[model samples]
Target: MNKKKYQIFISSTYKDLITARNKAMETILGLYQFPIGMEMFSADDSEQWEVIKQTINLSDYYIILIGHRYGSLTQEGISYTEKEYDYAKECKIPILTFIQDRNVPTTTDEREQDPSMSIKLNNFIDKVSATKMCDFWKKPEELPGKIAIALVKAFTANPQIGWTRVKGEKLQAVSSELAETISENRKLREKIEELEKLLVTQKPVLSVSLNSNDPIELTVPTLPSPSKYPQLLRRDHIPAHLTPYITDYDITSYNNSLPSKEEFEEYNKNTRYYHLKKASIDFDISIKNDGKLKAKDIFVTIELPDFVEVQDKFDSYKNVLPKNPIPKSLLEKAKEKYIKDNNIKPKTSFGVTGGLVALGSIIKPYSLEFSSTYDDIIPHLTKSQSINSWSSVKDKTITINVKNLIHTRQKTFDDFVLLPLKAGSGFINISIICEEYDEAENYTFPINVSK
Candidate 1:
């Protein structure tokens, strides 16, 4: 690695601190560092201030020496030394301050003759002392030693990227590499401009819409009663030959009664509701890509109000209920024959062979009993493939990833089911985001739910 030499800027009033400034410059040079000062330009000239700022910009560190005189003022009514210090601070250069000790006696020529200038000098000294930790110097000779110590500490604490001399061969190689890099950068910038123009003209246009824009009406259906089905009581008593015919209704009804508490608990892990009704509404949302380019990595998010709910799958009461292999008509006919044969009285309790218990008045046959061999009393809603494969439901929000949608193609998400928990009116918000679009496309549709 090449050793680096830092450039240090020395800022001070010329007449009062000329000797001190010289000592600072010598100290920096002795340390093998470059020194920049206002020696070349007249401090009072406006044009020289620009040159001073430029030098300060190139410097890694700033050293300011304050004495009895504030020095000559610029057009801005501030001393050139103070102006330079401000510019250094603006550039965020590391600064070292040396203030003259007030106790040290100074000759008439070395001190400020004007009262106004003396006040400004004292204020300037106070400003520097308040802002930075400053060293006190009694004489010009004290600056060299103090400056050397300060510079060493600064170098160790805050190292700077400074000047280094490279070999001739290495310099030529670096020059060639830099030239190639600049040329490549220019070509890349041109390509980027061309791409941006093409993007503006051939942008993908995406439109999202629902199958129906009319406000969705929500309705809640009564929960199916398990007591209506008598076959549930004979789940274990059903013949082995009828096991395949056992519908989800038989299982659900048996589970609801929970005849064996332990077995039912193990079989059903979800919460069970005997009376609470569940309501769900299904809808379709479609997205059409009309632009020339394909819309890649598309995500659609639908957010409903708190009263509405989105579920991955809605539980249906079908083969899940109690099942009995015997038909209800046969059971009724057998009961009438048994009554006529035994001459049983009304409101009599009797146990049938298949764990069938006749309760309440016999005058009223089980009012809700119905018999069907078909398993699909309640049809299953067809699930959308895209939703089943790449969708998630959380509370009232449903997020679906439709992957890449090709140009001039439309995709319909038909699996979304909205369950309303209560009656409410709100807008269903839909947001679509894709790689081809600069921003998300938002849409809304009204929904009114009634009990």
Candidate 2:
């Protein structure tokens, strides 16, 4: 068995991130691969660059770990680390970049001492971030896990031509076998030619019959009642008021003629109603295969147009009376008497004030009942959460398969509530993308919308 190992070049600022570089080397070694770094070269060494280029050329992958320092620069003023990265990129080596997390606080000693060096390091970091997909790590311990994932993904996506060794005896045997197979194949071809000359062949006449189905007429139906068919309330047809009920007091003030506790409980239960109109779109798709051979992986893509906008529902008030009614006559008279007497600003007498207080006490219970009803309606109103299920998606794409060459499929995407944006003669442009057919299958049709 021949085992292949990938040589990965690890380039980064050396001194400041010795710990991170060591961790990376450990990760590559643990994966049973080679890790090349700048450990052998001294600071500001220009002679070793040729050797570094040779190493990068031989490497299968390149990984760089960036830190605060830009490292020693060459005569050209470009850092040696950046020069190595440029060479690796020029050689088309697969590069994985790991950057130090900016959020992580670093000690002053750990960063570049020179301000210019710090600027160069930042510029280098920016270049790497923009050009390649990078990962940020705060600690050296995080390097192993992240590096492992990135290396695995890179190797899987673009596998390198790694070294492999074979036994001399096996190679000789394969060569001998290949020669014998070639000679045998040549003789077999000659025999096949002789046999073909001796055989007689004839072509058969093929007959074809044509049958057609009657034209299909698709009619758009009017919108149906929402109460009758709630499932049809999908898309634009879905009422904005999804809540089943809203109390009458919520819609209006109940200061004067407050209903009795029983009457308030029943009559103010739900006042909101949602009306629905028929939202139906019908269209036909025809598939024709002119070729004699059958096609596989046959598919059709249907792009539905922006049919309608979600609109408010038509509503009407329905009087829902409570079973046990509280006669309004007594409450009405009390309220009327209070209003009449309050017209005159009387003197501040305890007896007169107490009399007025008594009148309020009479109407206070009904007021409490009305307030209680408001509290009770809160839970029910909260439960009436609105969901616009159909409005979320702009269009639908369907892929289908038909058994025969000539086929017509009648497709109806019904129960989808459509609130036509415009009234009368609206065009729905359907885009059809067929995998098998070469010609364009797209078409446009008109729809009439009424509220």
Backbone clash total for model 2 is 4
Residues 155-178, model 2: lDDT tens digits: 788889865555699888888999
- After superposition, candidate 2 runs with Cα above 4 Å error: 168-451
lDDT measured at residue 231 in model 2 versus the true structure, 0 to 100:
24
TM-score of each: 0.44, 0.37
User: How badly does each model clash, as a count of residue pairs?
Assistant: 16, 4
- Candidate-wise lDDT, in order: 0.72, 0.57
List clashing residue pairs in candidate 2: 222-278, 223-277, 223-278, 224-278
How far does residue 385 in candidate 2 sit from its true spot (Å)? Answer: 99
**Candidate 1 residue-wise lDDT at 166:** 76
